[model samples]
Every structure is written in structure tokens, then in C-alpha cells.
Target: MTAMPEWMSPPRAEGWYAEDLDHLPEAPRHTELIDGALVFMTSPQRWWHGEVVTALTIALRQQAPEGWLVGREMTIRLDKRNRPEPDLLVTTTAYDPDRTWFAPEDVQLVVEVVSPESAHRDTTVKLRKYADAGIPHYWCIEDQAGAPVVHVYELDVPTGAYAPAGIFREVMKRPVPFEIELDLSTLTP
Candidate 1:
């Protein structure tokens, strides 16, 4: 077997830290830290995933209030050892050119466009993690016959868990995280 690349080695005995992602210039793009380990998104992105993410980013940006910001494929530093990159995020923080990852508290919503390779993590692991981190909103978008179906959830502050708000297809409208409506059909070509 070929030897592992030097950059692939963990910088600490406990595995990778969230902040370490910034210093590793040679690490692959979209690298994430989960439970103190590096997780790389190596699978080729499906065209549907890319299109939906781009379209959603645009749609969200258009409706975002002055203080809100919409971003795509940005990592959220949930904790010292967990920084998962959601497909899309809506934040209250102002634009910062040098910002690499967002703090969970600053993010109002996170959208994950589910791909086959990420279905389990997106539906289960991340679902739990994002809620535990106190993010107010989470939307997991799944492809149903080439159309995007959004599963929206809101945090139950008392329990520190997510409560299903709605599952939207064709169109999605939400009041919290700012009022916005989206025609899901337009997200895919």
C-alpha cells in the first residue's frame, strides 16, 4: 500500500482540531473535522447537488434582511473538535473576507443538500450535532425524482433537540430566520 501523505497525518495525538483546518494549506478543499478527526469530501459532486446549492444560495440571499447573510459551502465551527461544512448557511454576522468558519451561535440556519454518500451523516449525525450546538434552524434537502424536498426543523431550546417544523416540496416558506419563500422546482434544471 502507498504511504499516507504527510499532510494526512493528524497534528495531534487526539486527532484533528477545528482550528487546525485553517493552517493546513495542502489539505483538500471541503475538509471537515468531526470528533477530532479529519473527514474529506472526496466524492465527485452530483450535478443536482451543485445546482440546488447554487440556486438556494441565490434565493436565500435575495430574501435575506440587511443584517442577515447567506453563504454557501461554509464550515461552522460547532466546537473545538467539530466543524462541519453545511451546503448553505444563513448568518447574522456581517461579511468578513478572512472568515473561514462560522461560530454556531452566529449562524441562524444551516442547509444540507443530501447526496448519496452523505445521506446517513446529513440525516442522522449532523441532524443531532447541529441541534446539540444550539443552531436555531436546520434544513435537510433530499432529492426526490430530481426535485428538491426540504425538511425543516427548529430547535427545542428546553431539550436541546430539533422539532420538525415542516417538509416542503415545490415551495418552502418560513417565518423564523427571517421571512422567505422559495420555489423548490427552480432549484434544479
Candidate 2:
């Protein structure tokens, strides 16, 4: 028998899996599966979001150490039921060149640019997951009145959590993964 259409069918009550996502159409995207639930993303990201994501990706890529890969809107497999697509993330040398999703150990840092609907998850939910996975670093980027504000955190290994490292509104220069100099103002298109 032919398999039923996923995109057209009603939501699954059984929940979603990382593998199940692979069969869906690429266009008319929906939310990333989190803990097997179809959790929706915030309202569509405005143009500024793209500009900021692009700018941050470029700045991070230029300084990323050898063997590190910077990706945008890429999914990281935290577990069988949880797959989060961070806005931007830097993967370590462990990143498999042939793979689409990354393992926790393969990720050195995960950055999320907050949207009105995603602030809670980016700040609390994802923060906890990344910390528990021992991803090491997390950056929460928010655009306030057109200027990006960055909140940096470093993992407190003993606690399996992240400790606030810094809150940068303008010049974000820090030593995490590497020394990064990101100018928030430039991200606005």
C-alpha cells in the first residue's frame, strides 16, 4: 500500500522522530520536532532576522578554527525525541562531513537568535538541553530596537548547566571557542 502523505495528514498523535522528519517535503516548512512533539516556531522571521543570521554566520565562520564548521538553521540531534534547529551553531572537528545533523559532542557552540515566540525556549528550554548535552557554549542573540544584544554562557560542567559569561550589546569580544569580535549594529540591513 502507498504511504499516506505526511504534510497533508493530521498531526501524529504518536509523536515524531528525527528519522521521520527526513521524508517530508523541504518547502512550506513547519516547526522542528522537539521531544517528539511538533512544536511550532515563532511568527515568520522578518528580513532583519536573515540579515543578522547571515552576518553572524559570516563573522563566526571567518574566525572559526580549522576543522570547525558554521551552519545556519541546521538541526542537532540531541536525542531520539529531541532535535532542535538552532539559528546558528558551530560544530567541532567531530562534525561528520557526510552527515546532515550533528551529535552533541560534535557541537562546540549553539547560537539562537530570539524571536518573540521563541524567547522562552531559547532562554530556558534550549539552554537546559544544551547544557545537559554538554555542548559547552551557548549564545542567545536578541535584536533590540535594531541592535543585536548577545548573552553569552559557558557550561558549568559540574552542574551540567551554563553560567552567564557576559551580556554584550555592542562589541561582543570574548574567549569562548575563540576570541570573537562581533559588532551588533552591523547586523541590521
Candidate 3:
């Protein structure tokens, strides 16, 4: 029988905390904490996913107002036990080379480029979680027939839930989360 590695063992009876992710050097890149458990991105990312994420990051950064930052593959520490990494995020926090994660309050918008394995979590679990944490905006991008389709949502502060803002196919333009327009077709080959 095979034995599990020490780092794979839960460090506490209650399960993994958000801060524990930083201490585990053996953990895989893009490991996420949800409901006190670790979720690893073990599948090879498709080229479509890579291109879309990269292109979106560049587009967002180009239009971002001063003092705002666009980053990719960074986790958001929503609370003690939940830290999910969005594919991209726009933040008010200035550049910090040593930073590993952002607090929910600092995040202005989170974009998840949905892959097959992450579809359920991104569209449902994360949609609820981000809204519950008062993230203000969320964008879930799905590849439709080789083109990027963005589904945007805004936090309904009164209900602590997300309201559908808009969905864009060829182009995405929004005033909140800063005024910006993206030609979605350009995100991939």
C-alpha cells in the first residue's frame, strides 16, 4: 500500500486554514481552499484557456485606471477557510511583490476563465461565495465554439447575492469595475 505525504495530511482537526496554504511548499500551484479542504488544479490547462486568460489580463491592465492593478492566478482570502484563485482579478491594492493573496475588500473584480473541471465551481459555488464576501463584481468566461463569452455579475448588496449584469460574446463593455471595453474575439486565435 502507498502512504500519503506529510504535507498532504491536514494540519488541524478542523482542517486547512487560509494561511496554511502559504506554509506548504509541497502544495501544487493554484491550490485552493474551500470549506476547509484543498482543491488542486491537476489537469493540464488547454491552450484556449491560456490564451484567453493572458489576453484578458493584458486588455484589463491596458485600460485599468491609475492605482488599479490586474493580476492573474492569485487567490482571494475570503475568510479563514476559503481561498479560491480566480484566473484574473482587478484590485485597488498597489503592486506588492511579496503578496500572495488579496483580502475580499481589496478585490474590485474577479474573472474566472472556466475550464471543464471548474465549470460547476466557477458558475455556482464561487459565484455565491464571492457575492457573500461582498466582492462587488464577478465575471465567468466560458469558451463557446472557440470564442470567449463573458458572463458578468454584480453583487446585490441588499441580498448578498449576485445579479446578472450582462453577458458579452464578441465584445464586453462595462462601466462598473471601471469603464472598459474588450473585443472578446481577439482573446484567442
Candidate 4:
């Protein structure tokens, strides 16, 4: 007998669900696959949260190196068991639809714009997952205390975890190939 694929099985828990990915339905908003779990993305209010994400996206794009692809809400297939749509993803190159999975080799940086509802996951769940996957860089952008701030982490591959790279109230120049342009002052209302 043939083994059944995991996605064919019934969902196992709350806060996540498995998706065929190839045949997945288009979400009304945004969604991600995490540990074979379908994680829904909530729409942000028309305020600081939304504005910050927009600013980062534009800045990263402008600054990114020629071969690097800075994507917003892109569906990255991290592993067969996990897929998460980070707020901003700095990949080595543009995506090829023909591919089936995303490995650490394909990624250079992963950024998460934190919301109150997802504070825990951004710092814990997703952080660990990204680290274990060998993603080299991670950024957690938070807007809870009026001004947006960024916490950066650099992965230690052999250990499969992250170490503090820096914490900044302003956008710092990324050392990679990209050249991002962000004027934080104009990034809000």
C-alpha cells in the first residue's frame, strides 16, 4: 500500500492547518504555512502598524542588491512541514514557481513586523523556527510603543539559534547586497 501524504489527513489542531500548497485556495487576505499548519494573517488597522510594513517593503526593495529579492507577503515554502509568510523576506533571488520547497539556502534574511496579537509568536515560535532552519538574518519590527523599532538577530548556523545583532530605532544599512531607502519620518501619518 502507498503511504498517505500529510496534507490529505484531517487537520490536527488549532492555530494551524496543513495545506496541499499546490492546490491551496486563495485567501481573502493573507495566510502562511507554519509547521504544516495554515496560519491566517489578520489585516492591520490603518495606522502605525500598516504604515511601518509599507515603509519597510519599499526601503528594502530600493536597497536590495541586484540578485536579492525583497518580497512582501510572499509564500515561502520553508520546509515540507512548514511555511510562514514573514512580513519581509530577503531572498537570494526571485522565486521560481516551479520549485516545491524553500530551504535555508534560498533565504538570506527574514523580517517580522510584530503586532500585539502576534508578539509571542514573533519572538518565540517563528524566531526559533527560522533559526533552526538556518536562516542567516532575522528582524523583529515592533510598533507598540508609538515609534517603530527594530530588533535584529543573526543566526549561528551550527547551533541552530540566533544572537543579538543589534536593536535600532532607525533603519540601519543592511550589509548584504541590497540598498534599502526608508525615511522613517515620512513612513507615518
Q: What are the C-alpha RMSDs, in order, of all predicted structures?
A: 0.8, 3.8, 0.8, 5.9
Each model's lDDT comes to 0.93, 0.82, 0.94, 0.70
What's the CA error at residue 98 for candidate 3, in Å? 0.4
Clashing pairs in model 3? none
| Native-to-model Cα distance after best TM-score fit, residue 178 in candidate 1, in Å | 0.8
Better of 2 and 4 by lDDT: 2
Best by lDDT: 3
Query: Of the pair 1 and 2, which is ahead by lDDT?
Result: 1
In model 3, state the lDDT of residue 8: 91
Q: How does model 4 fare in lDDT?
A: 0.70
Q: Estimate each model's TM-score.
A: 0.98, 0.87, 0.98, 0.78
**Clashing residue pairs, backbone N/CA/C < 3 A, model 2:** none
Residues 59-139, model 1: lDDT tens digits? 988999898999988899999999999999999898999899999999999999999988998999999999999999999
| TM-score-best of 1 and 4 | 1
Could you tell me the TM-score of candidate 4? 0.78
Off by over 4 Å in 1: none
Looking at model 4, report the run of 10 residues with the lowest lDDT sum: 10-19
